[model samples]
Target: MPLYFYSTREPYGEFSNFALYGVKIDGEWWPTTEHYFQAQKFEDAAYRRKIRDAHSPKLAADLGRSRRVPLRPNWESVKDDVMRACVLKKFETHSDLRELLLSTGDEEIVENAPGDYYWGIGKDGSGKNMLGKILEEVRAKLKNAAC
Candidate 1:
């Protein structure tokens, strides 16, 4: 069976970007993968900082989705890589999260986000679930490193 995750209150919630896992990247600490991923959408350092310092992941996402500040032209091309890096760093930083991810043992991970079709399974379950794919990729990398 696939592992479905969405809210931070549910099982496998740790896999969600909204989970409370802080990662240090580029000499700065991000409160969660959501914060890091959202902030990277822009080239503007000040704007990035604003997203990074958001009080919560949801607020950071809101800021990221805002078009007020133009996204970096390369955002679409590089978003997956950025998410991969953030997820990898997050799992790498927290041993408990690593163990929990590995415990799934090759199960297909799905982000059960009804509203987000790209990073999750949409309402009809046809969404791309890119976040789940990224987690699985990170799981494989961590598993291999442990061998």
Candidate 2:
């Protein structure tokens, strides 16, 4: 199975990147982003403010308020919706990703996160593997969408 990076909102183990980072995903893996800011039009008020603050002048007189203020930290609840959108978008655009998923037989695909024993197979390969289940559900949705 091919391994790819799937960004996480928070770091896991030694794999940490605050500015921007990617998580490792196998062939059964899916990638999604949680950057509530970047996922917007640049010209939008909040996005523009983020850009402006990041590129602000050093002078106090030139300092402008940034609209990059954090929103409610409810990613845990919102992530499923985000993931669904990502799966649909990827299936629509990335032919390789779509082919990888479509190539699967009736067998349930498992994407094991290396460090997550509850959500992935543990070091001994025994766990709930919820992410894998989510992938399966997303795949089914995609298949139904195509029909």
Candidate 3:
């Protein structure tokens, strides 16, 4: 699956257009300033916007503020720098993501997409990661086969 980074408002109730870092499908970086995307940097925003917009047909709610690491330390509103969310199609190919964007818009795409993140945690806190467990199991199986 291709990982994409999208820029939305840093925090909810903030300016729409702001210069912030984002990620692209091809491991590219995207930055935005206020409501518009930083063109001099990477103008794929137009393409993304178009794709996201096209998904409005099955959309349930209006576009909401995008999410990213917390900038401010608002104890009431913002608690942690990393927000943990669960993307309930955790596995989808690049074409799947594109289809989702075009068919359901950004909101719906995100809604149906599967993902999650963790806040502040230490070494001991580093529990089982999905990919990590898979790799470990594969390694063990290979060792057993060799034996």
Error of 3 at 41 (Å): 29
* Collision count of model 1: 0
What is the per-residue lDDT of model 1 for residues 36-118, given as tens digits with 9 covering 90 to 100? 99999999999999999999999999999999999999999999999999999999999999999999999999999999899
| lDDT value, candidate 1, whole model | 0.96
| Candidate 2 error regions (>4 Å) | 1-71
lDDT sort, best first: 1, 2, 3
TM per candidate comes to 0.99, 0.47, 0.18
- Model 1 per-residue lDDT at 91: 94
Which residue pairs show backbone clashes in model 1?
none
For residues 52-138, write the lDDT of model 2, one tens digit per residue: 334212221122223344433564566456545544554555555555666564456554456656445655667666555655676
Query: Candidate 1 regions off by >4 Å?
Result: none
Clashes of each: 0, 1, 10
Candidate 3 off by > 4 Å: 1-128
Best by lDDT: 1
Q: How would you order the candidates by TM-score, starting with the best?
A: 1, 2, 3
Overall lDDT per candidate, in order of appearance = 0.96, 0.42, 0.25
Q: Residue 128: error of model 2 in Å? A: 3.6
